[model samples]
Target: MIRIRKAETADAESLALIGEQTFRETFGAFNTKKDMDEYCTKNFGTRIQQNEIADKNKCTLFCESDNRIAGYVQINLNAAFGAVADTSQAEIQRFYIVKNLHGKGAAQALMNAALDTVRRLNIKHVWLGVWEKNLRAIAFYKKFGFEQIGEHVFLLGSDPQRDIILHKTF
Candidate 1:
């Protein structure tokens, strides 16, 4: 069974580990080790995770299966994106699940939780960035009615990759 719950500050390290692992599992092959390491160093760290957990505008949720964390989602209430106006919107800054749990309930649970969170907070729109090459993720978001509104460059090490900015308006 997959259980979803708000992440606690104590889960910083575990969250960081999962972030790094899932990111590597999903995109490691296409990326150079140096690039991956640089990206991970800047984005997936215990201190950074902890700060996010403590941020008032951020909501972090964990998906647990068999007493172990299977995935997580981080929602930003104060979403800042050039594609959309900064009003009445939230952003799914990060959403990741272990490769083994892809077809399982982890991703669904986490995505549902994220949407529910924003809805509860009275947000009218939600957005997220997905790599252009991540076809699976793009399709998944499309299933949730997210439409591509813009694009941005995401720096992965020295490579500047394009990310599609998808949005869903309630």
Candidate 2:
């Protein structure tokens, strides 16, 4: 059985580890090793995880199976993206499942929790950005009724790549 719960302050290190592992496994092949290293270090560092755990309004939900964290989702209200304000929407900043648990429904469970939280918050919609090359993730989001809204270019240091901005009405 999998249990989904809000992440606690003590989960920062575990979250960082999962973030690093997931990023390296998923994006390592697409970008140069150096670029991937920099991206992971900056995004999944201890400090970032600490900050995330400290935010009460921005929820970080974890999926635990067999007493181990199998996946997590980070959601926020009043999201800011490149100067655009989405007051009535919640944004999924991150969602990841450990490689071993990919097809076992853990990801979907986590997503459902985040979506439910968004609805409870009375947000009209939920938005997220996925790398264009992450076909599996794009398909998963599509299955959840998220439609592509626009193209985004995320610059990781000097490397820039396109991402698809997807949204679903609550």
Candidate 3:
């Protein structure tokens, strides 16, 4: 059985593990080992995950199957990419699923929970930044009615990559 729930601080360690694993799996192929290691160590550590989980302006949701985390999504109500004109917007800061769960409904379930969180907050718009080269993620966002609004630079370690800013207005 699959279940979705709000992530708690206690789950930080597990979240960190999953976050690092999925991030490496998704981008390691296109990036250098040094860059991947730097980014993962700096951003996906347990302390970082705990801080994010404890942040009041952020909402983290986890999708679990058979008591193991399959994926997670993080939304930030207080931050937005400069491209978003609307101040009343929530940003989907991170959305990742295990590679094995790609064809399953874990991503969809996680996304649904994220949108529900946005609706509950009365946010007028929801936006996200996706790497320009990540075709699969771009397509998935488009399926959710997210349209490209602009572009921004995303720094992964020292590498500056372009990301398409996408938005979906309620």
| lDDT by residue (tens digit), candidate 1, 29-133 | 999999999999999999999999999999999999999999899999988666677589888999999999997767877888889899988898999999999
Question: TM-score for every candidate vs. truth?
Answer: 0.96, 0.92, 0.97
- Every candidate's lDDT: 0.92, 0.85, 0.92
Using lDDT as the measure, name the better of candidate 2 and candidate 3: 3
> Model 2: runs farther than 4 Å from truth?
80-86
**Model 1 stretches with alpha carbons more than 4 Å out:** none
**lDDT score, candidate 3:** 0.92
Clashes of each: 0, 0, 0
Give me the overall lDDT of model 1: 0.92
TM-score of 2: 0.92
lDDT of 3 by residue, 1-170 (tens): 77999999999999999999999999999999999999999988899999999999999999998889988999998876677677898999999999998978889888988998999899989999999999999999999999999988999988999999999999
**After aligning candidate 3 to the native by TM-score, how far in Å is the CA of 13 from where it should be?**
0.4
